[model samples]
Target: MFIKGVKILFVVLLFYLMTSTSTTPLEAYEETSPARRLHKAHALCTLNKSPPATDDNDNEQIVETFIRCMATKMGLWTDKDGYNAKQVAKFFNKHNYENEVMTIVDYCNHQHQQTNLDLWAYESYRCATEGRIGAWLEEYYMLSLKL
Candidate 1:
């Protein structure tokens, strides 16, 4: 009788261990789901301005929109006084890319000087994604275009 009781207890303990160690479907899905990954990527993508659409699954369109927006700001949004380096610095600081301010400014300045808006926009996207997020964006979201 005592041995049977011990066997039942052992089975219950095993069941408890198995259930406790295993993650539920929802928990497992949340970890590796595309939606979760996209959410993280989107945070960096639209860090400043609003993208074309919040729920838009078209990554290419979103990136193009962002690049165009940046180009416009760099080219057309300047004051009569001229380009605002402080504004650029503040923008990078906002996105936690403070160290990239000088690099981006230099890159965009070169493009702006060349008077090529198209090249400026593409280069801006490349320089912006040059940090830790670049690889992930390139591989998963295709945010980096071959230039």
Candidate 2:
């Protein structure tokens, strides 16, 4: 009976955590912390390194074309170059995902205005870390095509 009560308590706590997840990284951090946000981004990027989703008209022919398509998922889906990783990376950098992460980290260290609900978006700025995001995405898409 004691074990059953503990199990029920654990389930209730887990549900609260999941439902309480913030809509933004900062908001999430406000409830949690910046370290958690970074960990989340890092996890997301790493997970994305796997194969991507497929479209209806996709062909199983050339590997390069398919790979490029998957790599472009992080893109705005409106570029003329189609699946250009360079352009996508540029867009984020110029706009600000990395900056958002840095800002969060800054707040985490300095205790400034900390909230994932800031006006800016992490996806707004392209990644500025040596093509890390783009490369990971490209590689993942390529692998996905093979299987």
Candidate 3:
């Protein structure tokens, strides 16, 4: 009888663990990320401030829309595979995805939020003199300014 009880408990524990597992690992990790979206209606804008809305999914336009939508301040929306602040850190630390990260940062900072964007801009400015977000802006405030 005791053995049967132990087996039942173990089965229950295993079931609980299985149920807790998520199908979309990307969605699970970004459930509560501090990102937001920033974009203008009608005319989409890329992180580089280029005119947006191309057929290409990875084109500047789509990226601009995604970043603007998920920016921290706007809190408008987010997607499972969209960019975020973590990606910015990765780009800065590893020089990986530099263009994508910079564009996303500029897209968000320019339209939606400020403070965190500012911090990232500072970091971006110090790291590279000719990268996406920091270097692409027209003036110091536009590029370096966070909010």
Using all chains and alpha carbons, the TM-scores for the candidates as numbered come to 0.31, 0.20, 0.19
Q: What's the lDDT of the predicted structure labeled candidate 3?
A: 0.36
Candidate number achieving the greatest lDDT relative to the actual structure: 1
- Scanning candidate 3 in windows of ten residues, the lowest lDDT window is 34-43
Q: Any idea what lDDT model 2 has?
A: 0.33
Candidate 3 local Cα displacement, residue 15, angstroms: 32
Off by over 4 Å in 3: 1-58, 72-147
Which wins on lDDT, candidate 1 or candidate 2? 1
Candidate 2: segments with Cα more than 4 A from true spot: 1-119, 128-130
lDDT of 2 by residue, 1-147 (tens): 344334333432332343234344444454333234333443444453435428422212112232223233334222332223333334346345655545433333233222331101121212222244434434543543454
Q: Count backbone overlaps in model 1.
A: 0
* Better candidate by TM-score, 1 or 2: 1
